[model samples]
Target: MDRIEQFAPPAGTAGTTTDVGGVIERMRGFRSHWPPGDGVAVFNEVYLTVTETLGRHLSDGAFRDREAVSTLDVRFAERYLAAVDTAVSGGLPPECWRPLFQYRLHPGVRPLQFALAGINAHIGHDLALAVVDTCRTLGCAPVDLEEEFERVGDLLVMLEEQIREDLMPGPDLLQVADPLTHLAGAWSLERARDASWSAARMLWRLRGAPPLAEEFRSRMDAGAGLVGRFLLTPCR
Candidate 1:
């Protein structure tokens, strides 16, 4: 998945008119196995990025004090996979099509389509905490981690924005931003982990398909901007 979405493949990818054949033949670039379609590629790629990013923090005991948060992160991964399976087995109904975006090239593009949003923000936040810990461990100041922290924050926001239309979380979706206010102070490891898990729950739950595009066709009108924007900020 990462292979496909990271950028244009060596031979480039399926263009705007890509059919299943084009997606399978042209899509390229995973560090591992290459998926067959744009849907699978993009959704899985983004998910991999998010998970690996969070995993880095989890390894540092950022989640050591919060068993529940750790559990939720694990659970969200499992559930998100299931949701994707469900969508693939039976393509989304018209009302639920927003979950897949052709241009994203990363798997798991839907914000509200799956039950994973709650953990998304939380994982990102925990990742932030890990960054804080790493910096401190390396003898860097909190101020030194500020730029890095905002990068993760921007990532969380992008995840939120991508899934926004799919889940339609009302105003509550915006609440995740509030945690940013507290980021100035290096948070307790446990607090950061819990907050991250909480926000992920909210964001991932918005993963249901809403009417948007067709199967094997480009649906993301401005996907380049969405992800380009995310990259401009930086997280992983």
Candidate 2:
């Protein structure tokens, strides 16, 4: 099955529109349904903040290509939101998302891991595909959106630092030698962002050949899933 078909969102879950405001509303809706510490909610809250900021940036003309940036941001958020919908409805989420949902409430899985696993799936897999989606929507090539991609990526990198600080448990809850710190430090958003850029370029190149593109996308999904599973490995 195709990526979207593999884990279809329930009827009526399709995004109302791709505007920045719409994206934030959809994320907020998910946040309303899931608890503050739920794996999906953890990521959604972080992403919601990012999207709201991007919306503000759009109003102020912070981007040289506002339309391109908005479209890319909206499309990227949709993929993550769809996975949230599927998980909420008891459907099997994509493998890349399975670990986050499965280990969401495990006592041994730190909040940092929950946040990073979501980042892994979204950036390592969804991002590359999102770039392709944006290219299709804009009738342009990946090269055309490279600047916007970097701008979006920079936002993510900045968010990564804040998420760690915000989600970290109190000093009383963690020891000086906590294993969770080691586990969390193992993953890097910068490395993932660089790899995603390469993956996006490759997918765009293979766009003319459906079979090759599908194969590449499948491998990328599986590879990212493995990383997510590793990131979520219990570390008390």
Candidate 2 wrongly placed segments (more than 4 Å) = 1-16, 170-172
Best candidate per TM-score, number? 2
Stretches of candidate 1 exceeding 4 Å from the true structure = 1-37, 91-98, 101-236
lDDT assessment of candidate 2: 0.83
Q: For every model shown, what is its TM-score relative to the native structure? A: 0.31, 0.90
Model 2 Cα shift for residue 173 (angstroms): 3.9
Tens-digit lDDT track of model 2 for 1-236: 56434333335545546588888877766666566766667777788888898899899998999999999988888888778777766687777888887777777777778888989999999999999999999999999999989987898899889989888878998786887777778899999999999999999999999999999998988888999989888876
Model 2 clash pairs? none
- lDDT per prediction? 0.36, 0.83
